[model samples]
Target: MILFKAALATGVLTVGLSASQAAYAAPLSASIQSAATDPRANVKIDSKIQVERTEESASGEITTTLLDPATIKVIPGDKLLFTNAYRNTGGSAVTGFVVNNPVHPAVALTEVLEDWALVSVDGGKSFGKLSDLSVSETASESAPTSRPAQASDVTHIRWVLASPIAPGASGELQFRGIVR
Candidate 1:
Protein backbone atom coordinates (compact mmCIF):
# COMPACT_ATOMS: atom_id res chain seq x y z
CA MET A 1 0.00 0.00 0.00
CA ILE A 2 1.13 3.51 -0.73
CA LEU A 3 0.47 5.85 2.16
CA PHE A 4 1.13 9.57 2.28
CA LYS A 5 1.79 11.45 5.48
CA ALA A 6 1.76 15.24 5.51
CA ALA A 7 2.44 17.69 8.30
CA LEU A 8 1.49 21.33 8.57
CA ALA A 9 2.70 23.80 11.12
CA THR A 10 -0.91 24.08 12.24
CA GLY A 11 -2.09 20.49 11.87
CA VAL A 12 -1.32 17.14 10.30
CA LEU A 13 -3.28 15.45 7.49
CA THR A 14 -2.82 11.94 6.18
CA VAL A 15 -4.14 9.91 3.23
CA GLY A 16 -4.51 6.15 3.08
CA LEU A 17 -5.18 3.69 0.32
CA SER A 18 -8.93 3.43 -0.06
CA ALA A 19 -11.76 3.78 -2.55
CA SER A 20 -12.31 7.41 -1.53
CA GLN A 21 -8.96 8.66 -2.75
CA ALA A 22 -10.53 11.39 -4.87
CA ALA A 23 -12.17 13.02 -1.86
CA TYR A 24 -8.79 13.40 -0.18
CA ALA A 25 -6.96 15.21 -2.95
CA ALA A 26 -8.60 18.64 -2.76
CA PRO A 27 -8.37 19.33 0.97
CA LEU A 28 -4.66 18.55 1.10
CA SER A 29 -3.58 21.86 -0.41
CA ALA A 30 -6.15 23.77 1.58
CA SER A 31 -5.08 22.11 4.80
CA ILE A 32 -1.44 22.94 4.21
CA GLN A 33 -2.30 26.60 3.67
CA SER A 34 -4.61 26.68 6.67
CA ALA A 35 -1.90 25.24 8.87
CA ALA A 36 0.43 28.07 8.05
CA THR A 37 -2.17 30.83 8.12
CA ASP A 38 -1.80 33.54 10.72
CA PRO A 39 -3.11 36.63 8.91
CA ARG A 40 -1.01 39.36 10.58
CA ALA A 41 1.25 36.68 12.04
CA ASN A 42 4.22 36.04 9.84
CA VAL A 43 5.47 32.57 10.67
CA LYS A 44 7.45 30.48 8.24
CA ILE A 45 6.98 26.72 8.32
CA ASP A 46 9.28 24.08 6.87
CA SER A 47 9.27 20.30 7.01
CA LYS A 48 11.42 17.31 6.00
CA ILE A 49 11.44 13.56 6.40
CA GLN A 50 14.40 11.50 7.54
CA VAL A 51 15.20 7.82 7.86
CA GLU A 52 16.65 6.59 11.13
CA ARG A 53 19.57 4.21 11.52
CA THR A 54 21.95 3.18 14.22
CA GLU A 55 25.72 2.78 14.13
CA GLU A 56 28.43 1.82 16.58
CA SER A 57 31.80 3.53 16.74
CA ALA A 58 35.13 1.86 17.32
CA SER A 59 34.83 2.83 20.97
CA GLY A 60 31.53 1.00 21.19
CA GLU A 61 29.62 4.29 21.32
CA ILE A 62 26.28 4.14 19.68
CA THR A 63 25.05 6.93 17.39
CA THR A 64 22.02 7.55 15.23
CA THR A 65 22.03 8.31 11.54
CA LEU A 66 19.39 10.64 10.14
CA LEU A 67 19.49 10.23 6.40
CA ASP A 68 18.49 13.15 4.22
CA PRO A 69 14.96 13.03 2.95
CA ALA A 70 16.12 13.42 -0.64
CA THR A 71 18.26 10.31 -0.42
CA ILE A 72 15.96 7.96 1.36
CA LYS A 73 13.67 5.33 -0.13
CA VAL A 74 11.22 4.22 2.52
CA ILE A 75 10.18 0.61 2.90
CA PRO A 76 8.23 -1.46 5.35
CA GLY A 77 9.66 -1.55 8.91
CA ASP A 78 11.74 1.55 8.30
CA LYS A 79 11.40 4.42 10.74
CA LEU A 80 10.69 7.89 9.44
CA LEU A 81 11.04 11.13 11.30
CA PHE A 82 8.94 14.13 10.35
CA THR A 83 10.17 17.52 11.47
CA ASN A 84 8.50 20.92 11.30
CA ALA A 85 9.98 24.27 12.14
CA TYR A 86 8.01 27.47 12.64
CA ARG A 87 9.65 30.86 12.80
CA ASN A 88 7.81 34.04 13.68
CA THR A 89 8.97 36.76 11.29
CA GLY A 90 6.34 39.29 12.23
CA GLY A 91 7.10 42.16 14.56
CA SER A 92 4.51 41.08 17.09
CA ALA A 93 3.60 38.09 19.14
CA VAL A 94 1.52 35.37 17.52
CA THR A 95 -0.94 33.66 19.79
CA GLY A 96 -3.27 30.73 19.55
CA PHE A 97 -0.98 29.06 17.04
CA VAL A 98 -1.45 25.37 16.42
CA VAL A 99 0.38 22.69 14.45
CA ASN A 100 -0.98 19.45 13.03
CA ASN A 101 0.68 16.42 11.38
CA PRO A 102 -0.90 13.35 9.88
CA VAL A 103 0.43 9.85 10.45
CA HIS A 104 0.72 7.62 7.43
CA PRO A 105 -1.95 4.98 7.21
CA ALA A 106 0.46 2.16 6.50
CA VAL A 107 2.69 3.24 9.36
CA ALA A 108 1.92 3.30 13.05
CA LEU A 109 2.83 6.01 15.55
CA THR A 110 5.44 4.77 17.99
CA GLU A 111 6.47 7.78 20.06
CA VAL A 112 5.08 11.23 20.61
CA LEU A 113 5.39 14.03 23.13
CA GLU A 114 2.18 13.49 25.01
CA ASP A 115 2.34 16.84 26.77
CA TRP A 116 2.78 18.70 23.51
CA ALA A 117 0.03 17.29 21.32
CA LEU A 118 -3.24 15.45 21.01
CA VAL A 119 -3.83 12.53 18.61
CA SER A 120 -6.79 11.60 16.47
CA VAL A 121 -7.73 8.12 15.31
CA ASP A 122 -10.86 9.17 13.45
CA GLY A 123 -9.55 11.10 10.47
CA GLY A 124 -8.90 14.33 12.39
CA LYS A 125 -12.50 14.74 13.48
CA SER A 126 -11.83 14.18 17.20
CA PHE A 127 -8.58 13.89 19.13
CA GLY A 128 -7.41 12.64 22.50
CA LYS A 129 -5.14 10.09 24.10
CA LEU A 130 -5.10 6.70 22.43
CA SER A 131 -6.50 5.19 25.57
CA ASP A 132 -9.40 7.61 25.55
CA LEU A 133 -10.32 7.10 21.92
CA SER A 134 -12.23 4.20 20.43
CA VAL A 135 -13.11 2.85 16.99
CA SER A 136 -16.12 0.86 15.89
CA GLU A 137 -15.27 -2.65 14.79
CA THR A 138 -18.64 -3.37 13.24
CA ALA A 139 -20.19 -1.18 10.58
CA SER A 140 -23.67 -1.80 11.90
CA GLU A 141 -22.74 -1.31 15.55
CA SER A 142 -24.23 1.69 17.29
CA ALA A 143 -24.07 3.49 20.62
CA PRO A 144 -20.47 3.30 21.73
CA THR A 145 -19.78 -0.19 20.54
CA SER A 146 -16.13 0.38 19.83
CA ARG A 147 -12.63 -0.74 20.65
CA PRO A 148 -9.73 1.20 22.15
CA ALA A 149 -7.46 2.93 19.69
CA GLN A 150 -4.02 1.66 18.84
CA ALA A 151 -0.95 3.25 17.35
CA SER A 152 -1.98 2.09 13.88
CA ASP A 153 -5.32 3.76 14.34
CA VAL A 154 -3.88 7.28 14.55
CA THR A 155 -4.85 9.56 11.70
CA HIS A 156 -3.53 12.95 12.79
CA ILE A 157 -1.47 14.71 15.41
CA ARG A 158 -2.01 18.26 16.62
CA TRP A 159 -0.26 20.73 18.90
CA VAL A 160 -1.68 24.02 20.16
CA LEU A 161 0.72 26.65 21.36
CA ALA A 162 0.16 27.29 25.03
CA SER A 163 1.80 30.71 24.84
CA PRO A 164 2.27 33.47 22.33
CA ILE A 165 5.19 33.09 19.97
CA ALA A 166 7.21 36.30 20.08
CA PRO A 167 8.75 37.90 17.04
CA GLY A 168 12.09 36.39 15.99
CA ALA A 169 11.27 33.29 17.97
CA SER A 170 11.28 29.85 16.49
CA GLY A 171 10.06 26.44 17.58
CA GLU A 172 9.84 22.92 16.22
CA LEU A 173 7.74 19.82 16.60
CA GLN A 174 8.55 16.28 15.50
CA PHE A 175 6.98 12.85 15.36
CA ARG A 176 8.16 9.38 14.35
CA GLY A 177 6.48 6.39 12.77
CA ILE A 178 7.46 3.09 11.26
CA VAL A 179 6.62 2.23 7.66
CA ARG A 180 4.18 -0.62 7.38
Candidate 2:
Protein backbone atom coordinates (compact mmCIF):
# COMPACT_ATOMS: atom_id res chain seq x y z
CA MET A 1 0.00 0.00 0.00
CA ILE A 2 1.26 3.46 -0.88
CA LEU A 3 0.81 6.31 1.62
CA PHE A 4 0.75 9.65 -0.14
CA LYS A 5 1.44 13.14 1.23
CA ALA A 6 0.47 16.24 -0.68
CA ALA A 7 0.71 19.92 0.18
CA LEU A 8 -2.49 21.74 -0.66
CA ALA A 9 -3.21 25.43 -1.38
CA THR A 10 -4.19 26.02 2.23
CA GLY A 11 -0.72 24.81 3.29
CA VAL A 12 -2.28 21.82 5.02
CA LEU A 13 -0.44 18.60 4.45
CA THR A 14 -2.72 15.77 3.40
CA VAL A 15 -1.96 12.08 3.68
CA GLY A 16 -3.93 10.30 0.99
CA LEU A 17 -4.63 6.60 0.93
CA SER A 18 -4.40 4.85 -2.41
CA ALA A 19 -7.73 3.31 -3.33
CA SER A 20 -6.06 0.23 -4.72
CA GLN A 21 -3.85 -0.16 -1.66
CA ALA A 22 -6.23 -2.63 -0.03
CA ALA A 23 -6.18 -4.82 -3.12
CA TYR A 24 -2.45 -5.34 -2.54
CA ALA A 25 -2.71 -5.54 1.26
CA ALA A 26 -2.45 -9.10 2.49
CA PRO A 27 -2.16 -8.64 6.24
CA LEU A 28 -2.69 -4.86 6.14
CA SER A 29 0.23 -3.35 8.02
CA ALA A 30 0.59 0.45 8.04
CA SER A 31 3.68 2.62 8.01
CA ILE A 32 4.69 5.82 9.74
CA GLN A 33 5.23 8.52 7.08
CA SER A 34 7.62 11.38 7.66
CA ALA A 35 7.45 14.92 6.32
CA ALA A 36 11.20 15.48 6.46
CA THR A 37 10.89 18.51 4.23
CA ASP A 38 8.30 20.32 6.33
CA PRO A 39 10.90 21.21 8.95
CA ARG A 40 8.26 22.10 11.53
CA ALA A 41 6.44 18.90 12.41
CA ASN A 42 7.30 15.28 12.90
CA VAL A 43 4.24 13.06 12.87
CA LYS A 44 4.58 9.31 12.63
CA ILE A 45 1.59 7.27 11.57
CA ASP A 46 1.10 3.58 12.36
CA SER A 47 -1.96 1.55 11.47
CA LYS A 48 -2.27 -1.63 13.46
CA ILE A 49 -4.01 -4.57 11.86
CA GLN A 50 -5.91 -6.72 14.29
CA VAL A 51 -8.67 -9.29 14.34
CA GLU A 52 -10.79 -10.61 17.17
CA ARG A 53 -10.94 -14.33 17.65
CA THR A 54 -12.18 -16.84 20.17
CA GLU A 55 -9.45 -19.13 21.37
CA GLU A 56 -10.24 -22.71 22.41
CA SER A 57 -9.24 -22.15 26.02
CA ALA A 58 -10.88 -23.30 29.21
CA SER A 59 -12.41 -19.88 29.84
CA GLY A 60 -13.32 -19.33 26.20
CA GLU A 61 -12.33 -15.71 26.38
CA ILE A 62 -12.28 -13.65 23.20
CA THR A 63 -9.08 -11.92 22.29
CA THR A 64 -7.72 -9.46 19.77
CA THR A 65 -4.28 -10.04 18.33
CA LEU A 66 -2.09 -8.17 15.93
CA LEU A 67 -1.75 -9.73 12.51
CA ASP A 68 1.48 -9.87 10.61
CA PRO A 69 1.19 -9.05 6.95
CA ALA A 70 3.66 -11.79 6.08
CA THR A 71 1.73 -14.43 7.96
CA ILE A 72 -1.92 -13.78 8.78
CA LYS A 73 -4.39 -12.85 6.06
CA VAL A 74 -6.72 -9.85 6.39
CA ILE A 75 -10.29 -10.62 5.51
CA PRO A 76 -13.73 -9.09 5.82
CA GLY A 77 -14.97 -8.14 9.33
CA ASP A 78 -11.40 -7.58 10.53
CA LYS A 79 -10.99 -4.48 12.70
CA LEU A 80 -8.39 -1.83 11.85
CA LEU A 81 -6.80 0.91 13.89
CA PHE A 82 -5.14 3.92 12.27
CA THR A 83 -2.88 5.87 14.58
CA ASN A 84 -1.05 9.18 14.08
CA ALA A 85 1.54 10.32 16.58
CA TYR A 86 3.03 13.78 16.29
CA ARG A 87 5.73 15.84 17.98
CA ASN A 88 6.69 19.42 17.29
CA THR A 89 10.29 19.24 16.22
CA GLY A 90 10.52 22.95 15.47
CA GLY A 91 12.31 25.36 17.77
CA SER A 92 9.06 27.03 18.85
CA ALA A 93 5.45 26.10 19.38
CA VAL A 94 3.58 25.44 16.14
CA THR A 95 -0.03 26.32 15.53
CA GLY A 96 -2.49 25.53 12.75
CA PHE A 97 -1.16 22.00 12.42
CA VAL A 98 -3.55 19.82 10.50
CA VAL A 99 -3.36 16.33 9.05
CA ASN A 100 -5.86 14.91 6.60
CA ASN A 101 -6.03 11.22 5.73
CA PRO A 102 -8.31 9.97 3.00
CA VAL A 103 -9.81 6.64 3.92
CA HIS A 104 -9.23 3.72 1.60
CA PRO A 105 -12.39 2.72 -0.25
CA ALA A 106 -12.09 -0.87 0.93
CA VAL A 107 -12.39 0.11 4.58
CA ALA A 108 -15.40 1.36 6.49
CA LEU A 109 -14.56 3.77 9.29
CA THR A 110 -16.45 2.75 12.41
CA GLU A 111 -15.32 5.19 15.10
CA VAL A 112 -13.29 8.30 15.66
CA LEU A 113 -11.21 7.96 18.81
CA GLU A 114 -10.14 11.59 18.84
CA ASP A 115 -12.82 14.15 19.70
CA TRP A 116 -10.85 16.92 18.05
CA ALA A 117 -10.82 15.16 14.71
CA LEU A 118 -13.16 16.05 11.83
CA VAL A 119 -14.60 14.07 8.95
CA SER A 120 -15.30 14.87 5.32
CA VAL A 121 -17.88 12.98 3.32
CA ASP A 122 -17.68 14.95 0.10
CA GLY A 123 -14.04 14.53 -0.59
CA GLY A 124 -12.17 17.09 1.53
CA LYS A 125 -13.85 20.40 0.78
CA SER A 126 -15.66 20.65 4.13
CA PHE A 127 -15.07 19.00 7.48
CA GLY A 128 -17.09 18.83 10.71
CA LYS A 129 -18.50 16.41 13.24
CA LEU A 130 -20.15 13.36 11.69
CA SER A 131 -23.52 14.49 13.01
CA ASP A 132 -23.27 17.78 11.15
CA LEU A 133 -22.23 16.30 7.81
CA SER A 134 -24.46 15.11 5.00
CA VAL A 135 -24.22 13.70 1.47
CA SER A 136 -26.41 14.00 -1.58
CA GLU A 137 -28.15 10.93 -2.87
CA THR A 138 -28.84 11.49 -6.55
CA ALA A 139 -29.55 7.94 -7.62
CA SER A 140 -32.63 7.64 -5.51
CA GLU A 141 -35.18 10.10 -6.88
CA SER A 142 -35.58 12.79 -9.52
CA ALA A 143 -33.39 15.38 -7.91
CA PRO A 144 -30.59 15.09 -5.43
CA THR A 145 -31.51 14.59 -1.79
CA SER A 146 -29.53 15.00 1.38
CA ARG A 147 -28.94 12.24 3.86
CA PRO A 148 -27.12 11.99 7.16
CA ALA A 149 -23.52 10.98 6.70
CA GLN A 150 -22.78 7.50 7.86
CA ALA A 151 -19.39 6.24 8.89
CA SER A 152 -19.06 4.44 5.56
CA ASP A 153 -19.79 7.70 3.76
CA VAL A 154 -16.78 9.31 5.33
CA THR A 155 -14.16 9.85 2.63
CA HIS A 156 -11.56 11.82 4.51
CA ILE A 157 -10.56 12.00 8.18
CA ARG A 158 -8.84 15.10 9.52
CA TRP A 159 -7.21 16.25 12.76
CA VAL A 160 -6.79 19.96 13.51
CA LEU A 161 -4.98 21.06 16.62
CA ALA A 162 -7.00 23.48 18.69
CA SER A 163 -3.89 24.61 20.56
CA PRO A 164 -0.29 25.03 19.64
CA ILE A 165 1.93 21.99 19.67
CA ALA A 166 4.96 22.69 21.82
CA PRO A 167 8.42 21.63 20.88
CA GLY A 168 9.01 17.99 21.83
CA ALA A 169 5.37 17.51 22.83
CA SER A 170 3.68 14.45 21.36
CA GLY A 171 0.16 13.05 21.03
CA GLU A 172 -1.81 10.51 19.03
CA LEU A 173 -4.98 10.48 16.91
CA GLN A 174 -6.70 7.26 15.99
CA PHE A 175 -9.78 5.75 14.36
CA ARG A 176 -11.25 2.30 14.01
CA GLY A 177 -12.40 0.63 10.82
CA ILE A 178 -13.61 -2.67 9.50
CA VAL A 179 -12.64 -4.36 6.25
CA ARG A 180 -15.43 -4.02 3.74
Candidate 3:
Protein backbone atom coordinates (compact mmCIF):
# COMPACT_ATOMS: atom_id res chain seq x y z
CA MET A 1 0.00 0.00 0.00
CA ILE A 2 2.81 2.37 0.91
CA LEU A 3 4.59 1.64 -2.33
CA PHE A 4 1.43 2.20 -4.34
CA LYS A 5 0.84 5.55 -2.67
CA ALA A 6 4.33 6.69 -3.59
CA ALA A 7 4.14 5.60 -7.21
CA LEU A 8 0.86 7.50 -7.75
CA ALA A 9 2.00 10.78 -6.21
CA THR A 10 3.53 12.48 -9.22
CA GLY A 11 0.64 13.72 -11.35
CA VAL A 12 -1.54 16.80 -11.67
CA LEU A 13 -5.07 17.12 -10.27
CA THR A 14 -7.96 19.58 -10.48
CA VAL A 15 -10.87 19.62 -8.02
CA GLY A 16 -13.84 21.92 -8.65
CA LEU A 17 -15.14 23.92 -5.67
CA SER A 18 -17.89 26.41 -4.91
CA ALA A 19 -19.95 27.69 -1.97
CA SER A 20 -23.46 29.01 -1.56
CA GLN A 21 -24.56 30.75 -4.77
CA ALA A 22 -21.12 32.22 -5.15
CA ALA A 23 -19.49 30.21 -7.88
CA TYR A 24 -15.73 29.67 -7.51
CA ALA A 25 -14.52 29.82 -11.08
CA ALA A 26 -11.16 28.04 -10.70
CA PRO A 27 -10.03 24.52 -9.99
CA LEU A 28 -7.90 23.57 -6.94
CA SER A 29 -4.55 21.84 -6.79
CA ALA A 30 -3.05 19.29 -4.35
CA SER A 31 -2.15 21.77 -1.58
CA ILE A 32 -4.83 23.70 0.28
CA GLN A 33 -5.84 27.00 -1.27
CA SER A 34 -5.16 30.16 0.69
CA ALA A 35 -8.09 31.20 2.86
CA ALA A 36 -10.92 32.39 0.60
CA THR A 37 -13.62 34.73 1.85
CA ASP A 38 -17.22 33.73 1.24
CA PRO A 39 -19.11 36.78 0.07
CA ARG A 40 -22.30 35.74 1.85
CA ALA A 41 -20.91 34.60 5.23
CA ASN A 42 -17.17 35.25 5.36
CA VAL A 43 -16.28 31.58 5.52
CA LYS A 44 -13.19 30.04 3.96
CA ILE A 45 -13.39 27.12 1.55
CA ASP A 46 -10.78 24.42 0.99
CA SER A 47 -10.80 21.07 -0.80
CA LYS A 48 -9.34 17.56 -0.37
CA ILE A 49 -8.55 15.21 -3.27
CA GLN A 50 -8.15 11.52 -2.52
CA VAL A 51 -8.58 8.47 -4.76
CA GLU A 52 -10.22 5.29 -3.44
CA ARG A 53 -8.10 2.14 -3.55
CA THR A 54 -9.55 -1.22 -2.48
CA GLU A 55 -7.22 -4.13 -1.90
CA GLU A 56 -8.10 -7.65 -0.79
CA SER A 57 -5.74 -9.88 1.15
CA ALA A 58 -5.43 -13.68 0.87
CA SER A 59 -7.34 -13.98 4.15
CA GLY A 60 -10.42 -12.37 2.54
CA GLU A 61 -10.02 -9.01 4.25
CA ILE A 62 -10.12 -5.75 2.33
CA THR A 63 -8.23 -2.50 2.78
CA THR A 64 -8.43 0.80 0.92
CA THR A 65 -5.72 3.20 -0.15
CA LEU A 66 -5.58 6.88 -1.10
CA LEU A 67 -4.09 7.97 -4.40
CA ASP A 68 -2.94 11.53 -4.76
CA PRO A 69 -4.85 12.59 -7.89
CA ALA A 70 -2.19 15.20 -8.53
CA THR A 71 0.61 12.66 -8.85
CA ILE A 72 -0.90 9.65 -10.57
CA LYS A 73 -2.90 8.76 -13.64
CA VAL A 74 -6.67 8.54 -13.10
CA ILE A 75 -8.37 6.17 -15.50
CA PRO A 76 -11.94 5.09 -16.12
CA GLY A 77 -13.61 3.19 -13.24
CA ASP A 78 -11.33 4.83 -10.65
CA LYS A 79 -13.44 6.04 -7.75
CA LEU A 80 -12.39 9.48 -6.54
CA LEU A 81 -13.45 11.26 -3.39
CA PHE A 82 -13.95 15.03 -3.66
CA THR A 83 -14.18 17.03 -0.47
CA ASN A 84 -15.23 20.64 -0.03
CA ALA A 85 -13.87 21.82 3.31
CA TYR A 86 -15.14 25.06 4.82
CA ARG A 87 -14.18 27.24 7.78
CA ASN A 88 -15.91 30.12 9.45
CA THR A 89 -13.10 32.62 9.35
CA GLY A 90 -15.22 35.60 10.22
CA GLY A 91 -15.72 37.02 13.69
CA SER A 92 -19.37 35.98 13.88
CA ALA A 93 -21.35 32.80 13.42
CA VAL A 94 -22.69 32.00 9.97
CA THR A 95 -26.05 30.47 9.18
CA GLY A 96 -27.13 28.43 6.15
CA PHE A 97 -23.73 27.72 4.75
CA VAL A 98 -24.01 25.73 1.54
CA VAL A 99 -21.18 23.74 -0.02
CA ASN A 100 -21.54 22.82 -3.64
CA ASN A 101 -19.50 20.71 -6.05
CA PRO A 102 -20.16 20.45 -9.78
CA VAL A 103 -19.74 16.89 -10.98
CA HIS A 104 -17.04 16.58 -13.59
CA PRO A 105 -18.15 15.56 -17.07
CA ALA A 106 -15.88 12.52 -17.02
CA VAL A 107 -17.14 11.21 -13.69
CA ALA A 108 -20.41 9.64 -12.60
CA LEU A 109 -21.61 10.59 -9.13
CA THR A 110 -21.92 7.45 -6.96
CA GLU A 111 -22.62 8.36 -3.35
CA VAL A 112 -23.29 11.43 -1.29
CA LEU A 113 -23.25 10.06 2.26
CA GLU A 114 -23.91 13.38 3.97
CA ASP A 115 -27.46 13.64 5.23
CA TRP A 116 -27.86 17.15 3.86
CA ALA A 117 -26.55 16.28 0.44
CA LEU A 118 -28.55 16.89 -2.78
CA VAL A 119 -27.94 16.29 -6.46
CA SER A 120 -28.91 18.12 -9.67
CA VAL A 121 -29.36 16.61 -13.12
CA ASP A 122 -30.01 19.73 -15.17
CA GLY A 123 -26.46 20.93 -15.17
CA GLY A 124 -26.55 22.32 -11.64
CA LYS A 125 -29.61 24.45 -12.34
CA SER A 126 -31.53 22.68 -9.56
CA PHE A 127 -30.79 20.26 -6.73
CA GLY A 128 -32.78 17.71 -4.76
CA LYS A 129 -32.43 14.25 -3.25
CA LEU A 130 -32.40 11.49 -5.85
CA SER A 131 -35.63 10.14 -4.38
CA ASP A 132 -37.47 13.48 -4.63
CA LEU A 133 -36.15 14.52 -8.02
CA SER A 134 -37.10 13.31 -11.47
CA VAL A 135 -36.03 13.46 -15.11
CA SER A 136 -38.07 13.52 -18.32
CA GLU A 137 -38.43 10.21 -20.11
CA THR A 138 -40.43 9.17 -23.15
CA ALA A 139 -43.35 6.91 -22.41
CA SER A 140 -44.69 7.09 -25.92
CA GLU A 141 -43.66 8.27 -29.37
CA SER A 142 -45.94 11.26 -29.04
CA ALA A 143 -44.27 13.00 -26.12
CA PRO A 144 -41.59 12.85 -23.43
CA THR A 145 -42.48 12.66 -19.73
CA SER A 146 -40.80 12.88 -16.35
CA ARG A 147 -39.35 10.10 -14.25
CA PRO A 148 -37.52 9.75 -10.93
CA ALA A 149 -33.98 11.02 -11.21
CA GLN A 150 -31.15 8.58 -10.72
CA ALA A 151 -27.64 9.04 -9.35
CA SER A 152 -26.21 8.51 -12.82
CA ASP A 153 -27.90 11.71 -14.05
CA VAL A 154 -26.49 13.97 -11.38
CA THR A 155 -24.67 17.03 -12.67
CA HIS A 156 -23.99 18.72 -9.35
CA ILE A 157 -23.94 17.89 -5.63
CA ARG A 158 -24.82 20.18 -2.71
CA TRP A 159 -25.22 20.15 1.06
CA VAL A 160 -27.14 22.51 3.30
CA LEU A 161 -25.37 22.76 6.66
CA ALA A 162 -27.93 21.86 9.30
CA SER A 163 -26.60 24.27 11.96
CA PRO A 164 -24.89 27.60 12.03
CA ILE A 165 -21.14 27.54 11.71
CA ALA A 166 -19.90 29.17 14.89
CA PRO A 167 -17.16 31.74 14.76
CA GLY A 168 -13.85 30.00 14.00
CA ALA A 169 -15.61 26.69 13.39
CA SER A 170 -15.05 24.42 10.41
CA GLY A 171 -16.62 21.48 8.57
CA GLU A 172 -16.46 19.45 5.37
CA LEU A 173 -18.98 18.26 2.74
CA GLN A 174 -18.14 15.35 0.49
CA PHE A 175 -19.40 13.11 -2.34
CA ARG A 176 -18.04 10.07 -4.19
CA GLY A 177 -17.78 9.53 -7.96
CA ILE A 178 -16.46 6.97 -10.39
CA VAL A 179 -14.31 7.91 -13.37
CA ARG A 180 -16.10 7.26 -16.64
Backbone clash pairs for candidate 3 read: 9-71, 10-71, 11-70, 11-71
Across residues 110-178, which tens digit of lDDT does each residue of candidate 1 receive? 877546578998898887877788887865646446788887888898877788889899987777887
C-alpha positional error of residue 31 in candidate 2 after TM-score superposition, expressed in Å: 16
Give the best candidate by TM-score.
Answer: 3
Pick the winner on TM-score between candidates 1 and 2.
Answer: 1
Task: Point out the worst 10-residue segment of candidate 1 by lDDT.
Answer: 22-31
For all candidates, the clash counts are 8, 0, 4
Model 2 C-alpha lDDT per residue in residues 1-180, reported as the tens digit of each score: 223232112211112323343323322223433445453434433333333433566788666665443244556666766666666666667666766777767678899898778999988889899999888889757778888999999888887777877877888777777767
The alpha-carbon lDDT assigned to residue 114 of candidate 3 equals 90
Q: Choose 2 or 3, whichever is better by lDDT.
A: 3
lDDT: worst 10-residue window of model 3: 1-10
Give me the displacement of residue 6 in model 1, in angstroms: 4.1
How large an RMSD does model 1 have?
A: 7.9
Give lDDT tens digits, candidate 3, residues 67-115: 6665455567788787777787777777665666667676788888796
